[model samples]
Target: MPVAVGSYGQTQPSCFDRVKMGFMMGFAVGMAAGAMFGTFSCLRVGMRGRELMGGVGKTMLQSGGTFGTFMSIGMGIRC
Candidate 1:
């Protein structure tokens, strides 16, 4: 019997995987950015307590989604 010396495996991620990774990274960055900007804007606009929390949350989600979508598309295109 002969022994095989080489191993073969998937060296690249699939399209879906690339998109997913991009989305996750973009989402995180977007959320952080949204938080900083949202906080200042909301505060300057006089939002307080529950309103402040709601505003920030909304901003975070929106920005995260937008960023994630674009990043995913870019990643997919590069593939």
Candidate 2:
């Protein structure tokens, strides 16, 4: 058998892996932004307690999902 070069069993990440990582990173960033906005809006509207939590949750989920979907589409095109 021929000897392998470089890092042996360690392989470079494939396009799919890179895309998936990018998508996850984008989703996290989006969620953070959404949470900040939601908190500000809730405070502005005088929302309190559970209502504030609910608003933040909704905003985060929506933003993360939207970012993930768009990233998926973009990655698909690149592959």
lDDT of each: 0.90, 0.80
Candidate 1 least-lDDT 10 residues: 1-10
**Per-residue alpha-carbon lDDT of model 1 for 1-79, expressed as tens digits?**
3333446843556678899999999999999999998999999999999999999999999999999999999998997
Candidate 1 C-alpha error for residue 52, in Å = 0.1
| TM-score (C-alpha, index-matched) for candidate 2 | 0.73
Pairs clashing in candidate 2? none
Structure candidate 1, residue pairs in collision: none
How well is each residue in 1-79 modelled by candidate 2, as lDDT tens digits?
Answer: 4434566686556678868876887789779888998889888999899999998899898888788768766776785
TM-score for each predicted model, relative to the true structure: 0.86, 0.73
**Backbone-clash count (model 1):** 0
Model 2: runs farther than 4 Å from truth? 1-9
